[model samples]
Target chain A: MTSTLKTFMEEQLPIIESHMYEFVEDLTAPTSLKEAMLYSLKAGGKRVRPLFVIAVMEYLNNPTKAGYTVGAAVEMIHTYSLIHDDLPSMDNDDFRRGKPTNHKVFGEAAAILAGDALNTLPFGILARLEDVSAEQKVELIRLLSETAGAEGMVGGQVLDIEGEKRQLTLDELVRVHENKTGAILRFSIEAGAILAGATQEQRNLFVEYAYHIGLAFQIKDDILDIEGTTEELGKTAGKDVASEKSTYPALLTLDGAKEKLAEHATKAHACLEKIPSNSKYLADLTDYIINRNK
Target chain B: MTSTLKTFMEEQLPIIESHMYEFVEDLTAPTSLKEAMLYSLKAGGKRVRPLFVIAVMEYLNNPTKAGYTVGAAVEMIHTYSLIHDDLPSMDNDDFRRGKPTNHKVFGEAAAILAGDALNTLPFGILARLEDVSAEQKVELIRLLSETAGAEGMVGGQVLDIEGEKRQLTLDELVRVHENKTGAILRFSIEAGAILAGATQEQRNLFVEYAYHIGLAFQIKDDILDIEGTTEELGKTAGKDVASEKSTYPALLTLDGAKEKLAEHATKAHACLEKIPSNSKYLADLTDYIINRNK
Candidate 1:
């Protein structure tokens, strides 16, 4: 089953990767910066966010091209965030995805520039996607800006930074995790629905599914921090505990955290039930999020 | 004569400032990031880029609202660039517009994030503009991205940064300045025309006008580095000379630089001649660029 999941994931992964390469290539400028950006971009991640974007788009039966613009865009934003997040001022992690983080290779200033270059590359890619109605394009840009900006990912980062060495309520913890991890997840699903011309009702249900899965995803991450080895997770484990940062397992017992994960998984699958039975991608993604070990 | 120019500049500056503030409040995330963003935003600069955007819009008789979104957006992108440029690794300047640079106040990391926040916020604002057709909006986003990204401003920056402490030919110098300073200027004028619904012919002329003035603007800047005092220029004078970076004046004799400025100014005026004779603001802007002391 593990092998099968990896195989299935491997097949879908390159489609997003190819689109990301094309979009980044199209978006970056000045040969040196483009070369630098392309180097780190192709270095590798699970392509989780872009895959989420395309998978959601596929689930909605939208033509895949629309997702390319947003797919690459979200990846760039995520990559840029990672590049910046791992800088010396923040997490200061040296390795990401089994390679040196951007700052590690590029130095802080160039890494910052590379990240800045990557961040703006998305809007450039979004601008290039053709044949979508103007309304949909505008909607896509709006969704992206909101998710990537302060109210979403960056806001979560601030809280994450600020919340260090202090206790956080479950509600506050949820807010941070949701914005940090969930906003992009929600954006991925919603963009799929919007492009597929899914009814608002359908999109709302997808949002519901994303919300639950988003929470589950983070809880699993917290669980992995305690249970998984560094080699397996490809990042240092137990750092949250070491740093006294809040996590599901920090705020609750391991059993309680495990129970929360189960509850969110159940809610995610429940939200999936409200959608058409034909959305195998949605169903599989929900299961995949709860079941995946890495 | 100086008072006339000052009066004209002063009167229009506040209109742009108030419009920018109101739009940020409506669109930006309610977080400290936004507050930091507004601090640099309202802290003050010439607002020249947005003024160019709006002047073209007004010349075309477009609604002021249309200009607000792109106007604010161009400013955000411009400001973000300045914030990053002022970092310790880059220009390392402490003062801008006679106040501490964003990095100085916020520290490098937060300053970087603050810039990232502001950079993305422009699109958020642009996406919210009402009454624009979807097509126009997409085009506007694309244009702004093209101007701001590596192929344009960022690319120019790379050249400028790398070219320092080395000799560059006149062609290389022009190429750098065009990308660094010219593209955004072109974007400003063309953005206004695009928003205001100028015909291709009218836009073509404005494009020509912007191209000329953009070059003239840089030449004037180069001249100012030599001719103006630090107090009058409001920043350190001769930093370029000190840095060994090539400028128009660096490559050309002072007389040659002045002569080139006049030649570019004449070309800028000829581009304006294609518009109706009554377009005083457009004409006045060209004159302002050529004659300004600081």
Candidate 2:
């Protein structure tokens, strides 16, 4: 990671982690339910989504405490999706981030409720955000819902599941990734812009930047499933190919997938260039996305 | 049912149904996902929760189109909870409302996604509510996430699941029902009051009324499990007793449970009386909750 980006993560991640943990901890839920929700939140994953939110805010030099709250909310959403995706009925994974999946430890019922609770909590977090205006909260909630709901993450999941049963074309794969991963990435980036009060022009540019990075993020994931070790990736590796699930490498070949990733990386950089901010961290974060093994 | 409620249902039920169906239909989501969502939605419940929202508006004489939107949102939440509750790892029910459960029809993954989507769509609905102010939308979303999320329905669900392994004390059982079922019912009543511009005093009264009816609603459900036929209840009757689940009748005895239901009904009625509005429909709905066969 670039020193600039490393410094940013060093400063922000603890704050982000604490906000997420404290929020879940403070809920007046049953102890077991709270534990289940916390199990996955505490289960370490790269806080990439929240970082995107924070990075964008920092780039604009308009950081707010609400940004961290929003960051926490997005991370919660990501955590919930991971929990549900690992369910016996879904990916049926036994582990994630080097730890047993939520369902593995909490059992399927608790895991499902944990996922459900995590999903519901983010909007509440956004809704009760004190630093942002009511209108901004409304906008954030609306955007998050659109990107995360049926037409967004959930819908994309359905597509991905359906894709597993067939050989999807490149266009179809892109569509799947766009919704499954791109939607939330878009929210993370755009939300920062919204929270930072970015200009319409800057917001538009960030959306383009988000589009490229989202695909790059997923493409790197597919590439890592093949190229990285299970220990390094902190999860079962190469299971995508074992299951004959359609992935970038399956369709494009490894070299072609790398080329595609680089293509998006360049485009993402181009979008960032137009944003006219100290986007060094965001630019480095983009490099981090392409280079990261996990 | 009282003629007031009968007329109210006849007039408003169609509106509620259409609003919900159209909202899902118009979404730019996968067709199959939409179908899965709509299948359970169309499976037909009593529409009690949405009706509560609308009935509150009618009672306050400050009805708005947003009331129906909020009603539809609550119904979506109710529908989503039912879908998840009937999952294989959860209640494992084969049927609901005389039809196959969501997972039975759509497979486990799709049903889970459908429930997730439904859980998410409500906040978006409220966020984009045309007639309500941004502040109100924030309040509604905050209220929803609290009542329907970890500290509310999901927490209640965890308690209910744990309660299944052993007998729960009366207070524990009430806590279970309050979060699992009562939270959403509370949201329905309070959302209506918020949308109708009710005074704080009126809102407080509705909350108290919601509390009473919430317990009454669950108590009636337990009674129906014993007394109502599978055909009448549109689900497996007597399963609670069969599973030796700790329900009101299980702890309080059927007679004690009925008396408790009556007590809540009386309290609910008293709260409604304190609100100076045309509460005839609300009163009838309360009666319907206490005495309904399904």
Candidate 3:
């Protein structure tokens, strides 16, 4: 299971993205709607969430079709969130991943429908999966829906919208990030654990691992907003500052934010050390999150 | 089973509303987000979809928690669709059911998120149900998502938006309404059938019944748009004509439109007659759909 992380990702990313494209393609759909969905999904994403599922399965020396299906499903949810977040009513961003946003290309109504479709396709995919036990599938679906639903990502979105209007305290910021970013990342890792048949103890470690990386991931994003260039970041740089929105770097200085990022990355790596699996890929991914220019 | 329909509705409507309100209430969260969600769900209206589930369950004499849960879940999806459909990017309606739309009350961003949450919360509710087998739950969820997802309600919505811009052929209009309105109503009746363990044959009849009634329902809506005043309709009247949107009465003469409505209602009744369940309520409900002023 311990292999060159780059080689492993090289082998996995294509399959993951292909699976994603396959799930969304329909025989007689409006061409624009399907195209809008595929454009955002295929925009050269890192495929971190799906890969987390795959890597976790690889780490445990247990793999199943459930891994790929759930992997693609989580990635769909993530992509849909991005699509919606970029709407005129929300962040009003013109670009994502260095390309025009979905609305910019598809028009606002189609973009909204595309986001709705992507957000919705995952559960249907999970429910249609028959290779797994009904109980297991339900467990995975329950966890996914709850984590991605109102009290989680959507709730965090509400808080984020509010935060754009006013400065949030540190505690409020933490709560927001944990719900928005942490919830889905947590679902990504936990879904893999469930499919891998991990014991509660191992699952807890994965939870701890995802928790640290989730925060680290956001903190790095905030840092990148300050330090990274537009080309490097793909999206516009200094967007948080331009919008007058708070970020880790906004509240703490840049150096303080970098330190915060390191602390969480270290904690995440330490948690991975406790798990009895070849989790080095996850370890490498955590580092990659902090070091990524975009 | 054949009690006065109004008497039965009076008894059932409050409980259904309560179930809805209960699913969305979350402590330790932003009061405004929750408030926005509740405001739409609590808006006075005929809880027709949820009531369909309850009535179907009663007709089959197969009452279970799944009925209430699925009823609430579908209603949530219905409400969420209404919210998103009213957004500035979509229909841009100022009022619905005689009150300001969710975006008018909650701001555009919150309204969008509120719709997202409601659309999402249903699958979680289905997944978390313990009374039914996981297989059953999965079936329910798969059906719900598929009917409500891209190829179904959302797909229909894309066509509806397109229809507003140009005239649609009668067949195209039928496709749009079936997808947008027919699918959810189909899911409602079919869900109760699944819960009651109806044979595939009965489910097919329910499908036909839903199809006929769904078209009838839309034709009646078009008729109301032409004949009803703004006060009776609760939203703007003559909207289809104002927008140059095609309708049954537009494609056919007004008398012809009435004949078409009657034709579908007759077909719906014939299908209902074949089902063995105590379906008087469904029959009465179909009559209500075509005759209601609003």
Top of the candidates by lDDT: 2
User: Candidate 3: what lDDT?
Assistant: 0.86
Error of 3 at A232 (Å): 0.8
Residue B75 of model 3 has an lDDT of 91
Clashes by residue pair, model 3:
none
In candidate 3, how many Å is residue A251 off? 2.5
- How far off is residue A186 in model 3, in Å? 0.7
Across all candidates, what is each one's fraction of true contacts kept?
Answer: 0.60, 0.93, 0.69
What are the DockQ scores of the candidates, in order? Answer: 0.61, 0.94, 0.69
Worst 10 residues of 2 chain B by lDDT: B274-283
* lDDT (tens digit, per residue) of candidate 1 on B207-233: 888888999999999899888999998
Query: Interface RMSD of every candidate?
Result: 2.0, 0.5, 1.6
Considering every candidate listed, which one attains the maximal DockQ? 2
What does candidate 2's lDDT look like per residue over B1-294, in tens digits? 988789889999999999999999999999999999999889888999889998899899988888889989999988999999999899898888888899998899999999999999999999999978899999999999999999999899899999888999999999999999999999999999998899999999999999999999999999999999988888889999999999999999999999999999999999998887756888899999999989
lDDT of 1 by residue, A58-122 (tens): 67666567676677778888888888888887788899877888777766767777787777768
Q: Tell me the deviation in Å of residue B43 in model 2.
A: 0.6
Cα RMSD of predicted structure 2: 1.0
Chain B TM-score of candidate 2 stands at 0.98
Candidate 2 residue lDDT tens string, A159-228: 9999988999999999999999999999999999999999999999999999999999999999999999
- Candidate topping TM-score: 2
- Report the first chain's TM-score for all candidates: 0.94, 0.98, 0.95
